[model samples]
Target: MTRPKSTSAHVQPTLAQLRALIAVVDAGGFGEAAAELNVSQSSLSEAVGKLEDLTGRPLLRRSARGTVPTPAGLRAVGHARSAVQAAGDVLLAAQDDSQLSGVLRVSSFRSGATYLLPPVLVAFRQQHPAVTVKLLDGDRAGAGEQLLRSGQADLALIEGVSAVDLSLTPLLMDDYLFIAPESRGTQPVTVQELAESPLLLSPRGDACFQRIETYLGRLGIDTSSATEFEQDSVTLGMVRHGLGITLMPRLALLPVPDGLVLLPLPEPLSRPLAVATLPWRARLPLIQAFTAALVASLGSASGQTTPLALPVWNQSPKLEPEARG
Candidate 1:
């Protein structure tokens, strides 16, 4: 008599399968997820399909709005993220605890990426040449935190991080300033001037721009006529042309562009820039190493010791003195 074939009762999922599921869910479609993962659409679909087969459940819902996680997928996605993060930690654990090596993925907003991270990255590279650092976009408000929660990034340089789950390391207090064409001169901007100026605004989702709008609105200033620019440099360029004035963080206005002047705001305003990471991952050798490099770079840049805590916000810190004249 022929014995009946038996199938295994257990189901197992590979990191690739879990990652494929996550990408599809996050991107809301196979095509976009495939592009993000740098894989063929068909292959990505296949990976998701296999994951579904193993779990015996359909994991995505396709609709006019786009692909989204099914009920089961919604339940599973969080676990999948945790699993992937664990896999990374395993690699981290395997490394010589004294020496750091592996990919360190970081996300940051435009200003931090441009002015803040470069020196830190340079210092980090010099110390740990074996580690590859990847910078991802965190341009929108809360984008950095979202990337961290989704396990897409190891660290995020963010402004005023409010997420309770992540651990924060305060880096700097970046003051907001009134920026104007040189023709406007070295005078501090008055509230009336700020309220009446044709404002060159950053794009809608920018954190700094949103804060400026909120602060102005509280003072009864109307922002409806502001012209939005996609790039900070472009907005500054327009300001230089005498098209409009803007309120910007000092970091974004660095090097005191030759044609513009930085003026103190009528009222003090600042944002706290910090490095964020999952609480558990905060002490990972790689992250700790990066933190040391970051602190060292900040000290070197400021020509002063990097403070352990961020300074109080809205302290009316002196504007760049050289830009006054």
Candidate 2:
């Protein structure tokens, strides 16, 4: 028998090191990741440092803004995610099938979670009492897509179908409504009139803001002088005080605050909200169960007489999404 060539320089990384690197990248900083993972920041740093040493490459770009993964670090983190997911799958596979049980990590924007998820969650709990569902904040633009792609979340409820890479199941169509104080009357405002008015914009760097900006800009509206607010509540308060008029999706205006009136814009715009997941994960029993529950819950609420299609994981040509109610 021939002996294999002698080689000993390569050192495999421990699961802890892999997890630390992934957590830092996902959470955007060691401090944040440490807090989320309930570990000391120093220990998280140490694990990432050791991982870098073992891999023979710099894995993080640390600076004042925050820590971000280096190019090599990103590649390493991808493999790390696969390894971690595989380990999780092993545990799930070994569990008894008497009751489907596992963690389903979902990332969703605040509006969707607050207004659309409660009923769906209630149904899911009734069906799978043993499963645990964890919700992560995905309020910022692209947060949901990134979380799912990075393996941090199993499901992501995001606005719009921009994330074509994932399997998307449209849940609702939220129309953009012109919002102003009731004192402003219920008259429909045209784009030119809106531009002339003081427009209070939503928090910057979100899908809602981006869509509104693009739509208004195309219509020759100059938003340069528009004041931006960090919180939706603050924006609504300002609108109530007649500081400016604003645009908001229907869902975000749930339980419309007293003294505010919502009117349809002369030129309508709408958001197609959808639930997304990795194509393969859509077929998992836990995800499928959730999907069925979501369809049943939302479908019932919308008074849809037709049966909505439940999610089925496949890579065939995409079908036209069901008409948004």
Candidate 3:
């Protein structure tokens, strides 16, 4: 009685298999990988050997201490992670239904996803725990476009006063506040006054800062002296440590992170938050569910009778075809 070969040929590598490979290398032995994977040692060895044979490279070496990947194996791990993530994306996509069972792939910045999305996502999970949610991080201008362009994600939450492509819904209305250390004092700092003082900003080329720049220019101040940070969360962190001040949305406020105050922007400096999606995504049920959850969360947080509505991701109504002059 011969044992049957266990690897699937017709399909791309399954997440379980890739993860098992990763486990074998990370754990340093087939036995440990099996234990971690909750399978028998024999099964783990066969699976890993199958993976090794399939890739045509020696992925692991049995050493005195434990297991580790060869040079080729290390590269394999990186590819395996991406394959596993893509597989996970597929699994999430397949689960799409009223239950939001599929994966809800969302791309946003560090602060936007961490602070702005939790309440909505929390509510969404409660409504449909079976649905897998993947929140990716990207910049306001770039991240949203990445989700739509990569076809890996279905929706995006971009915070800014400007518009992107024609396929975006403008969910406007957020007053970008100048947050600073409590030591900066209780009085609200004017944008000009703050800009002159080594302002900490949320990255260059950020749509949020662009809007702020135009608004500040009206007040006769130039922000060329401003300093920017890559991570949205870090920008806030620097302010907390007395680095400088930054502007962010109201939803980005949660427990205030200590030693910081979300001061109201000077009047008339308020900005809009936009939600963009692929035009075809108008029909995605999971996207719709997340949108509903987002509105509900924002309404509850702001204490407003009407929550901001999700924008139409289809071509923007603001854009019109130009005359062929």
lDDT of each: 0.82, 0.80, 0.66
Angstrom error of the Cα, residue 80, model 3: value is 21
lDDT for each residue of candidate 1 in 1-325, tens digit (9 for 90 to 100): 1223225566588899999999998899999999999999999999888788777778888989899988888989988999988988988966775678999999999878898889888777877889999999999989999999888899999888466799998887877888888777776678899888899999877787799999999888988889999988899899999999998987787656777777678888988888899999887889888877777677665555663333222322233433221
Which residue pairs come into collision in candidate 1? none
Candidate 3: stretches off by over 4 Å: 1-100, 160-172, 181-184, 188-192, 231-244, 260-262, 309-325
Per-residue lDDT of model 2, residues 224-319, tens digit only:
888898788899899999888899887787657877777777787988888899886676777777776776777787666532322221211121
Measured by TM-score, the strongest candidate is 1
Worst 10 residues of 3 by lDDT: 311-320
After superposing candidate 2 on the true structure, give the runs of residues whose Cα lies further than 4 Å from its correct spot.
1-17, 24-54, 58-71, 90-98, 306-325
Report clash pairs, candidate 3: 28-67, 92-103, 95-102, 96-102, 166-316, 173-272
All candidates: CA RMSD in angstroms? 5.2, 8.1, 10.8
Residues forming the 10-long window of minimal summed lDDT in candidate 2: 311-320
Candidate 2: residue 282 lDDT (0-100): 72
Pairs of residues at least 3 apart in sequence or in different chains that clash in candidate 2 = none
